[model samples]
Target: MLLHASFPFLKEASYLASIYPQIYLDFGLRIPKPNFHGLMSSVKEILDLAPINEVMINSSGITFAE
Candidate 1:
C-alpha cells in the first residue's frame, strides 16, 4: 500500500510508514517545490520515523515546466 502525495501529511504518513511494513510513502510533486532547507527539513521529518527504503518518489509522469 502506498500513501500518495505524502508531502501534505509528512508526519502522519511517516508515522504510518514506520509502523506498517507494507506501507510506503510517495511524495508526488514534492521534488520541485522545496528549496534546500525545506527539502532537508521535509526529508528529516520523514526519516525521523519512516525508513529511507519505505519512502518513494514519483512524478506521476507529469512535469511542471516554467
Candidate 2:
C-alpha cells in the first residue's frame, strides 16, 4: 500500500531486464519487487506501536461529525 518513494522496495530495487526479450538494444524495462520480509517487518513494527494497533483492528474509520 505504500506507493510513495519511501517504500522500501524503491530503495532496494535495481533495474532489471524486461520480461520479454528486447527487440531493440537501446534499453530494457524495469520493475520493482520488494524484499517481502523487510517490508513485512516494517509493517509489524508500526503495528506494534501501541493502542493504535488495537483501535486499527476494530474500527473502519473515525469521523468527528455529529
Candidate 1: worst-modelled 10 consecutive residues by lDDT: 26-35
- lDDT per residue for candidate 2 within 1-66, as digits (tens), equals 122222343322111111212211111111123577754554444334322212122121244567
Runs in model 1 deviating more than 4 A are 1-5, 29-34, 59-66
Q: lDDT of each model, Cα atoms only?
A: 0.74, 0.28
lDDT of 1 by residue, 1-66 (tens): 554536567898888998889888886544544578887777778789988888877766676677
What TM-score, computed on C-alpha atoms, does each candidate reach?
Answer: 0.68, 0.26
**The candidate that achieves the highest lDDT relative to the unseen native structure:** 1
